[model samples]
Target: MLMRIILTALPFLSLATASKDTCEWPSWQDALTTCHGPPSTYTVKASNGKGLGLFSAHDLDVGEIVMRETPPLKISPPEIVKGSGYPMPAVTKLVRKEFDTLSSAVQDEIMSLTYHITSSKEATMDKLGIIFRTNAYNSGKDIGLFPKIARINHSCRPNASYYWSDKLNKRIVYATRKIKKGEEVYVSYIPLLLTQEGRQKLLDRYGFKCSCDACAQERAAQDVSDERRTTIQKAFADFEPQLTLEPPRTKKARQQARKNAKASLQLTELVHQEGLADYFAKAYRVAAISHARVKDWKVAAIWANKGYELKYIEDPDSPYTMEMHNLTSNFIANWESELQVGQ
Candidate 1:
């Protein structure tokens, strides 16, 4: 059953890159062209109350790969000068090296599109850091890339989950839950389940005040979600000891662990449906580990594959996927052997 879900998801993942020829890339191009003065094939539209957002010109479904964009510029952390301080001579030298590497046309485009930070103490040095900080998406392995997806303003509860696909060499955002036409797709800039204080702090730091539906939910629902998540965390913490304990673990203990893990998995699904993809990966990981401990390789393989799939969406060719692939292979081999013995 778990294998079936993974297999089904592969097709959806492929759709992210489906030909724009059929879906109408011109509208997207026009939108990007209008917004940034670039003739790129991504469109910007009013995302209802969410301000400006990026969306497909054609219909996009769950798991479909969206546009893949390479960052116009790349900056390493060391290359960045901290605080509002002036760039040391060394920093200037590195910036020049990076600037010199780009083609003149690309250089012209970047300089044209660049926006400077107004208040940096080291105005020139801080400008670059601010841009990268706002624009760069971690493509796993500490690599950061830029894409139009970064333009989409965040919601406390987001409609979509963005992953960096290493295999496809693009950042892909998928719907954690179904979306309809004309909906403003959103991604969470911060963890969705954080306490209100934590959520507000993150929002302020990111330069946006979130007024998304989940953030606006009645106090009752919010409290319920908080309580459920707390319970899930406590159950997971409790189960960890038994996982390390020497067996002949009692049947009751094992059953209870599985039950708790299942509840957590269900809660994660609810959160996903509520537009929280950031938590989905962690929730799936817990369930996978619990299933493995119970010797349910099939379910373990499924959840393990889910984690890999989500990671792949964010970073294709990631170490995470490679490790999961190996685990899945081992599980399948073991399953085959067990089948033979039963026969």
Candidate 2:
């Protein structure tokens, strides 16, 4: 378990107090104590203009669950649009009513969230709307406000991935790679497959420029990265034709399928080398299926195990996980026995 640190002792207090509604802000200790959820493996530290970000307190292995918390404040767009949905004022009133219902401590914490204000002189309802838009996570149909997890910053090439787990009834954050002590944990706010330019555009709505390695590369380097990603996209599209339920009957067709699979793996590797690790499991899955298509169960088993291990970290109960497990087991059982017979 990692220990929690107070925010007041850190640098976020100046901004927390800068608002005209400073009185509404949580007290020094309240601000410090508010974002501290149950301990697991991270501690909060000042991230300059990015505010406070979660940092690993120890060396964490790939696929390890780093943090888990059920959000304290959750609001839905439907709730705001319940009556006279067209009128912003009516929706604003609904939001205010909901905010007023929370305990003073919770309300203070909610108000303390980093948000862009349209009008500083705007109504509290309007401010509430801005807060909800800025901080809310779209949990399928409903948007949830998670003060604690909101502090986690964004990275296009994030080291951590987050997903909502129904079994745990919490939003779980897991390390996607080995994260060293003092490394800041991050999650992608948007899909990772987008080009750097497209990603920056999406993140613009959040009022911060992304400084991720993928985004900060020199123009020549960025062009190379983009070209690699484009090749990966084309290779995956071409490989789709080879994934038939029935394996190719002709030797020529089987050779073509293997060629396509190898091409896809080659392209995927180039993409991964560009610091986009999100494609790693997808590439391994393609390799597993490609090898399995040719009855090369030994190679298939190795790829399947790699893919399954990665998928299991994010979703242990996923159907994909079960499929991978069954495929790996079948390959090992069949191939190991055949090897023994040959020996």
Candidate 3:
């Protein structure tokens, strides 16, 4: 009876070990399953200028969740900082931990996996900092999940947006614009709708020269957009002093505030329509402020909510999202308070 029991257990143990062995380093398939089937219909292959990049295997629509991946290794912020100087030791430790946790087959797969490493002090620091700075997938947190999505190159006018869903325990990339078959999907590593100089500085920090269509066009349109945004901002600012001046609140000041607010909204909407979601938050904020000046709390709240939603879509727990939530809540509360006072 004992011998019979041991024979039965042997197959189960063998199967378990085999499962581990097969999953050693983990493939895209493994990550997909782990994340409950994120709408990833792409594969990574070598590209000429960019290193390995994700190419669409089929047509992908806007808002479609593309790659859903778990970090290969999740580390804390301190751990990341410690590993910054010489990460091989930390990498080895992490790899060993992963290997030990995984089945033998997975361990073998991981052992064979290749990682890009830098040896020089300047190069290594630069590389590590870039990784830290450009790492938008997880917001530079020490989360052990590295996804192929991180390798996607940047574009000023990006076709995709990434969101880290804590509920799903995975980082999800969504197409903000339609992607054609064989198109290389990209997301802006930095906010692109800023001034040309600001965008260029960010690109330089990321160690890449951006030649995206939007970047090219922005050189010509930069002055125009800046002038428009500045004019709108100034008009909005001018309304404040009028609001405090004298008793019977003049209609001219109110009208001017409304006009300024409307103009700002139009410019902001134009930016959004131009695929400048990166700057939508700021534009939305300007609209919200204008609406607030006109005492149109509803419109103010709505724009605030829109900005909140966009921030939530980009980064759920970001400071921007929290601010939006607070602003919206206060608006509602104040409205209700005013209603009670009138009654």
Candidate 4:
């Protein structure tokens, strides 16, 4: 299957990149160029010892789509996850079964990705199995393989981020901030809210130790980043439950909601200071919901605007984007009504 969309997008809010970016997919037009060279703001080139990476061929804005590619390969995730959440879902057989179903052109695209073959005493899978394990991106219902997206490489602090677009049936890479030409676009392959040590533990799955700018900070600075991220993680754990579309039914619940919202707003400022631009649109959306929960429509509108500005750039024409836009343009009427959830 093949699909191609132009290299363009909505306006940005200085939200995505940090003088960096940048990273994926397949179509007839895309089958191989993504692995070799693709015509867009980015291209695939050797990324030193890290293998081939997607590089920005020209300067890109905070809002630009570095690349939007329909996947050449898609596979279902195992009905059951193994060990907390990980590998070995009959990889040897799964890849062989699915691999035979692909078009030769798609097969070539699949082959272009780098892989790390593993062997158990009883079985050793083919290269495609290793490739599938290493590169699959989670899209709703099924995971997919976007060879170019796989090549962008990892960083503790990535300048760009990738989102699975169910609406477009493609993976979109959008700048998290302004990125320079020739800069290697990075995305966080591990949890960004973990400390360096914690992130490294997870990066083990990828078979490399990250030495991104965030990881290379001096001892004192690194400790500071670790603390910030740890706090962010804890705050998120405490705050996520408070995010709701329903109105509070009792005075105690209303007071608790306000307290949680305020705490979340404080966390937002901390994330921005830590240069986690990827967290902003979502944090802002949480802020909006909090304010609206208290009937503070004016402030809620302000927060929704911030979210809409960045989310619009990351995902345009999606239903969520439309909902975000409505929250920004008609906060009182739209969100106020939504607050009636469960009532």
TM-score of each: 0.66, 0.77, 0.58, 0.75
Candidate lDDT values, in order: 0.56, 0.68, 0.58, 0.73
TM-score ranking, high to low: 2, 4, 1, 3
Model 1 CA deviation exceeding 4 Å by range? 1-42, 79-129, 139-147, 164-170, 229-275, 305-316, 334-343
lDDT per residue, candidate 4, 62-95, as tens digits? Answer: 7666787777777776656655454555654666
Against the true structure, whose lDDT is highest? 4
Best by TM-score: 2
Clashes of each: 12, 0, 12, 7
**Per-residue lDDT over 42-118 for candidate 1, one digit per residue giving the tens place of the 0 to 100 score:** 46776766556866544544444445565655544344446744344554454456767878886654443323344
- How accurate locally is residue 31 in candidate 3, as Cα lDDT from 0 to 100? 27
Positional deviation of residue 182's Cα in model 2 after best superposition, in angstroms: 1.4
How high a TM-score does candidate 2 get? 0.77
For candidate 2, lDDT tens digit of each residue in 206-310? 888888777788999888767776777777677676654367789998887778667656755776686565667777777877877777767777777777767
Which portions of model 3 show Cα errors greater than 4 Å?
1-35, 46-48, 57-61, 79-141, 218-260, 297-343
Rank by lDDT (best first): 4, 2, 3, 1
The Cα RMSD of model 3 versus the native structure comes to: 15.3
Candidate 2 wrong stretches, greater than 4 Å: 1-38, 75-98, 116-125, 337-343
lDDT-better candidate, 2 vs 4: 4
